[model samples]
Target: MSEVEKRYLAAKERYAKIGVDTDEALKKLQEVKISMHCWQGDDVKGFLNPDGELTGGIMATGNYPGAAHTPEQLRSDLEKAFAMIPGKHKVNLHAIYVDTDEKVDLNTIEPKHFSKWVDWAKEQGLGLDFNPTFFSHPMFKDNYTLASPDKEVRDFWIEHGKRSRKIAEYFGKELGQTCINNFWMPDGMKDNPIDRLSPRKRLMEALDEIFEEKLDENYTQEAVESKLFGLGAEAYTVGSHEFYMGYGLTRDKLICLDAGHFHPTEFISNKLSSLALFSKGVMLHVSRPVRWDSDHVVLMDDELTEIGRELVRNDLLPITNIGLDFFDATINRIAAWVVGTRNTQKALLKAFLEPTDDLKKIELENDFTTRMVLTEELKDFPFGDIWNQFCELNGVPVGLDWLKEVREYEKNVLLNR
Candidate 1:
């Protein structure tokens, strides 16, 4: 047997001793598709304005060489990233990334603007997800759109939101998978606003107007994301957690929980179970936040593992949509994709390999000692072996082998750009 097969066999036997079937874990994990956000490839500089400055308190730091400057380049970079990641996954898109020659603003964007992406997705056998670019445009005047008191500003955004759903529906119909069109607005105040309720109310009314037309749930799922604070909007945010939580519950919409959007002390992992109880479904924007909402590349950190554990242990996977949302222009963009995506997959695999039933049984029986012991022991398990085996199974380069190819590509493809 090969080294990978041999290691996997040994690891499988070890896990089986704890009543964990590594094979079953791997099988389940293979089917879980993580939506790889495309903005990371181009530093959130969508095709709409490749050279424009980021508004909405959004920033993609670093002058990383070879940032995608066009749709074809972005697609090529995505393809390169996908090759390194095991298991088929979806590509997440922002409306600003629309690939078309026609002159169309956000208010007029249609599904045809993204037909090229749909065609490429079909060719790659991948699914598609979408987000409306509510920030960085002139219409987003005074750090507001939907919540803006000006009816014209609100009307412009409402139309964009409407068209975004149509495009998402088209993606679902063409790709044969539900497209999660998430909405996140950078509508807030730099200083503490005296009247937060009014803006929130306006946002609610605008959202209601946008969702008035019901589309088939099979084709599209809408999610609203909440942010704590942003660069300019450090004092107050209209779409606070409470606001989106109540809105999502009342409207039966998917609530997107972005890891970096919360305070450092707050954990989205702990909120998943609660949301599963009330909301129709949940969407995860898995990211890494250092001190502030700095969108660092994801790592196989403790919190990440806990998020994975919560999903698996509570059986929330079926009701949750997973997606990555971080941009680090400091390093190689393609490597950023591979690292973040692979780490996320690894987190899920670790959770899947846990003897969840046994742990729960012990805990329920008041056998705290055993539960703690097993959980700690799992930290030392042959997880790397299983990860390597997974990579081999999926025909992707194993371990650091993929890094070599990334470097070669940087030298050949990235440097030229």
Candidate 2:
């Protein structure tokens, strides 16, 4: 047997002794589909933009030389990145990335605009998730939509939301899988306003009108994502977590919890149980936030592992939808996706390899000292070997060998771009 196979055999036997089946862990990890965000490849600069500049509180900082210039390039780069990842995955798309020949305004977007994407996704054996872009358009210059004072502007946005749901349904029908349609808005104030209540009421009414036309639930699932704050709206966000949590429960929609959307001290791991109890399922936009809501690439941090553990232990994988949401233009764009995705996979693998059943039993028995020691000892297990074996089984490059592949892709394809 190969060195990796030999190492995995040793690790498997060791884990089995502790009542943790490494073979079953690897199998479970394979079933997880981390939804990759397409915006990372193009730095949030979609094709519809007149010029590739971000506005309306959306920002991707870095002048990376090899950013994908077109939808074709973005797909090519994503394919390279996906090839390096060792599991089934999906892609989340913003409406602005729709490929079309005509200038399709926000309210009039049809399934045809994204037909090519559906085709590409089918070819890759991938499902799709969607987001309606609510910022950076002339219609949102006043920094409000679905909560705007002007009836005309509010109605226009309502139409967009309704149409977006239709398109999402179409994607689901075409792909033969359920598609999650996420709705997030940048409607808030830079400074405190006198009439916060009025705007929120209007926002609720607008959302009511938007969801009035219910589509087929089997094809598409709807979710509302709430943000803590934005650049121009630091003082208040109309779609606060409280608002969306209640809204999600009442409306029977999934609540999307972004890691960076909460305060620095808040972790999504703790919030998952509360949401899973009420909402049908929770959607996750996993991003690394250093100090604020800056969309940094994900890493194998403590919180990521805990988040994975929370999902695995709670049996929430079937209900929870995990997706990446970050853009870093400073590094090679494809490499960013590869590294972030691999880290995320590694974290999940660690969670699965854990003796959570026994740990919980210890906690139940009030054996705190023993549980603590066991938890710390688990940190030094042969997790790397299991990960390597997983990559090998999935027919992907094992260990740092994938890093060499990414570097070669950058030099040959990205450098030329």
Candidate 3:
């Protein structure tokens, strides 16, 4: 037998000796809570009525609509959105963008708007989340990976990072909600190799700045306490893909793996989850993968079921929050809300039913081949069936037939590529 096969057999023997109960493992998985990153555009579906004065609302269909509003409009919209969500479904707000054409100014925009949202969230009991990127601006079109040798481009990126730190600090103090900065830089190419080292350096430098701001001595006197900052990176970006050796992997940051983002690259989602668990990050961005683009559609049967099982085995946090990172102009706002929420709920239920110990053992095993096989198995599980099984096991009422509805909606709405 080959060395890898021998290692796998040895690992399996060790696990067998310990003997995990699948039923008990499934129970533990059920305890994990799920949440979603809220966007203004997502609320326009018919489930919740739009407060006309506010930019968006939860529609009857259960999805939210993207609302690209001015600062003033955003404040009002957030107030309404918080009031609409049921206490059972956790709501995570997206990074506050300045405008459609520009990235939101953290210093100015977050302080005013974020403070307002915090107060409103407190009243409603909701959490906030954000994505960290400088891509929205025209200047960052070249890169925010921080490798630009050009002084002007580098300076712009630096300013953006500084803004992100200030914003994180403000949210930490005012909201007490952990600020999750999802860092996905449009800064690399598959063919052309750039100064690969600089991007990582720049990312670490920006993180250090944020850390320093949180530790600033001046903030000790504030009446309100700040939230701890958590950082998450997209599955793949410009330069090197996947977790590479020698790259400084800090414990402070969590790896945010998007399901749809990795499908085309053959980057194994379950293995990525294990790496994130090994490194220790807060949560994962659970969404469906398609083509090269993040279809951001609802969870597929095969994709998320496997991820959910792996999460349980690895003891990774399940959908601490969900991000419907999709763009669809055709679907009426109401349909979007229903679709997003339904898909998220379905995915979470399936993941919650997975055997936790099985996942945990796979994660703890030293054999790389066994881990790889486990990850592959997880990616192929029947997630939709698992979700139904979970609902039946828990004796909870399954409210909507979202898969059928979404299929119909996609036929009419999803734009041709």
| Backbone atom clashes (below 3 Å) for every candidate | 0, 0, 44
Q: Which stretches of candidate 2 lie over 4 Å from their true place?
A: 50-52
Model 1 lDDT tens row, 341-372? 99999999999999888889999999999988
| All candidates in order of lDDT, best leading | 1, 2, 3
**Top candidate, metric TM-score:** 1
**Number of clashing residue pairs, candidate 3:** 44
Q: What lDDT is reached at residue 184 by model 1?
A: 91
> Candidate 3's residue-wise lDDT over 1-417, tens digit each?
544334434543433343533344345545443445444343321111223311110112333333433444444433332222222334444444333333344233444545655565566555545554434344543434354556576656556555655555555566565555554445543334445566656654544544444444222111100111101223224323343211214434445555544546454444645465354443455554455443444534666656544554454554233345543444443344445545555544445534445555766776667667755665455444444444445443233543454444344543221
Candidate 2 on 203-321: residue-level lDDT in tens? 99999989998788889999999888888888999999999998999999999999888888889899998888888999988888777788888988888888888888888999988
Measured with C-alpha atoms, the lDDT of residue 86 in candidate 3 is 22
Residue 398 alpha-carbon offset, candidate 1, angstroms: 0.5
Local distance difference test, each candidate: 0.94, 0.89, 0.43
Structure candidate 2, residue pairs in collision: none
The TM-score values for the models, in the order shown, are 0.99, 0.98, 0.60
